[model samples]
Target chain A: MLTRRLSLFATLALSLLLVSGAQAADIVRLATTTSTYNSGLLDYLLPKFEEDHPYQIQVIPVGTGKALRLGRDGDVDLVLTHAPAAEKAFVDADYGVEPHGVMYNDFVIVGPSGDPAAIDGGEDATNAFATLADEGATFISRGDDSGTDKKEKHLWEEADVTPDFKGFRAAGQGMGEVLKMASELQGYTLTDRGTWLAMKDKLDLEIMVEGDTALFNPYQVILVNPQRYDGLNTQGAQALAEWLISDEGQDLIDAFRLKGKALFHASAGEKIDPTSAVHESD
Target chain B: MHELMNTAREALHLLLSFDPALWEIIGVSFRVSLTAILVALPPALLIALLLARVAFPGRWFAISLVNTFMAVPTVVVGLVLFMLLSRSGPLGELRLLFTQRAMIIGQILLAMPVLTAMLHSTLQSIDQRAWETARQLGAGWWQSLWVLIREARFGVIAAVLAAFGRIIAEVGSAVMIGGNIEHFTRTITTAIALETLKGEFAQGLALGLVLLLLALVLNVLLGVMRGRGHQTVSI
Candidate 1:
């Protein structure tokens, strides 16, 4: 009798787990970056998007590379990321389509208040990086193959410097954790403005350099190609992509702020040249 | 069905290559769990002894608290430790965040409640006359404690094994506190999480297979040891 009851309870528990697991897949899966998720932009915008739509969106925050890979694997219905080259590669690979401009933010070189590298307010990000490298000031790199990490590598390449010194620490972590490491170590790091503004209060670092055209960061949303995967919620993903670029979405992006400062400048509904590096001055 | 066969093929290829990355993750998982269980053992055993043998005010409440703590989520522990270790936190001066030490500390907290609760029950169910007889035979307090522990050695071993199991299999706190930094704090479970999220099913399944094999080997080792030298406790 006891064994019979034990088997029945075990069966009930297993079936309950199965039922819940099945219910979880009813929503649209969107893979996005940590910047959008951590900066509270998604929290502000997703509810508004879901209000008029039939689908509830599930957001998976990961690095740009992983987001694209998830899109390629058809594990997620769509992706929103900021790495242009990688995003283009994903599109070229036939994994995603309809890449729409969502918003724009810029990267800033943040460092200690004392400014040991003395590159504060520099117009050229590469020049500032060269100075930091020459001075051997401690620098933290995300090193996680994130979009931010890719941007930092581009700046290093432009600066003609190898950031391989002992002072350079490649922390395979998120932007917020990297900022904390930089703060504690009094090091310099490159971060998107959205994450910086959201987490600035907790950090002692300041923006040492900004306004370089290369520092411009634009976000894009893309729907996964349904032809490559079976049973994908392609219609749901397209609806989300469409809603994000709508006038309501653009206005919501413009209005979302962190501490009275707008985190992302809205650029939706604009005819953005896909190849153009930066649109800030234009 | 085809994916399963492909994953099996990939797992075999990874295993046959004697891959350094796979072995490194397995090593990290074992090292972290071992360090955490070792660090927690003395304190957990002491707490168990105190709760089991001593009759004090609110002892039942303390026992209930331990029972409750055993069910606490790993993510909650990770979040509390993450805050404490963040640069803006009060203890941030130590700069211990995102390090292997932080991962070990998180795992210690994750495993401690399991160890203490299991060992507490183990000590409680032991024959109380064993302690009394040890004392009557001129055994001192420390000697009597040791005698009781020895009498309940099998249960104590089981508790240690259970704690090891809990910490080794945990992913939430390890990812949050450890940051899943590759070549630094990434364990088998965290690597599996990263790979699975990145859509690298083969690598994730390979690490998962390693974790399962490790658990199987450990349980078998425990069974053999139990049958050889120590009398088994059914519980």
Candidate 2:
């Protein structure tokens, strides 16, 4: 009986290996932020790409810090993330190449409808952060070092307020989880407009602050340095990155909307001025 | 290979340095799992005793149901608890979601079936005459039950340890309901999960080492207990 079972196990393992090996070269590993995945943008875009291309894009949704780290480590073929500073650092270190601006979205400070910090409709994210600190209002931070987390730290630094307040919660989780926690605790949090729009109906939180030039979130698609690692599907990565910035990809991004509202503005090949105050065209 | 070696060396250094954050994660794991096992013990024991000793209707069906629940994945448990404790759910008024208490409750649910199934088999393995002898000697029902439990003390302790090991290492429900909040609900497993995602291998490796050491210690204790139980039975 044991011999028979062993033979069956060996056959099963061999079949699994054959199945995976058949499509190994056609797979492109793309590490991206949870914000993009949670906003349902990739879901809308990747199927179209796969329908036309021979490559099957395997998306690894993580925080922006981890996403960029994955690119640096050569663990992924490509990365798509929103943290421009980190992306610049990655490219400067020669860990990545061929960076392209894929799209743009703004961050918003969301809080309970009651607006305990009383900074509703505030244009300055830094001032709103200071008010939250001064009022000792509960704030949920995405302590996971995500793109939004880095932006929140920048805002806190600009406000010159230490985030060691009594009600400051460092939730080492993704954007969606942080938003849910903020709503559950009636706390405030900074989130990308895409994820906020996608999950707004399910959440009780409202947009308390917006339109800050400092809140600009620009996304980039970059390829891992092909020379750094062997066996990387560099061609597949280039194909995906090019498709993301191509006219077809740009149009698809512009047309992808949630609840009849566009979540991302395609900005392929455009020099992005992050501090330029650009309002969302309703 | 060189990078992995350096990470392992750093992990060892971190483990020896007594990092407060690392120890805090360890403490959360033990506190939540220990409380879960302690809370689950009494009810699990009672249910096991009932299934083993009592001949109620559908007794076999209850045993099968418990064994079935043991196969339920930990993430499914987390999803169910997440919904129940969600702000819009029925029990949302308690405000227990994303707290240590919520994690404790999740672990309790995860621990119950394992404890019940293991304890039932332990109680079943006891000599049937032990209970009868205790009762005929003028002991009450509860006293007789205590005697049977004492007769199976080694198995009971082993069951508790095994269940504790299972819950302490569980990351699914803990991550979903606990929210992996730093200085609050970040257990060793959840911390390892987050650190690995963040591409920081040293902390993840250190926490992995802690879990490995714990599994070794628990298994060793279990082996010794089984040996002692064997000797006792033979004697």
| Per-residue alpha-carbon lDDT of candidate 2 for residues A49-124, written as tens digits (9 for 90 to 100) | 9999999999999998899988888999999987777777788899999989999888999999999779775698
User: What residue runs in model 1 are displaced by over 4 Å at the alpha carbon?
Assistant: A1-31, A37-61, A75-78, A98-103, A116-121, A130-140, A159-173, A180-187, A220-223, A230-282, B1-8, B125-148, B221-235
lDDT of 1 at A62: 94
User: In model 1, how large is the Cα lDDT of residue A195?
Assistant: 87
| Candidate topping DockQ | 2
Clashes of each: 0, 0
At residue A218, give the lDDT of candidate 1.
81
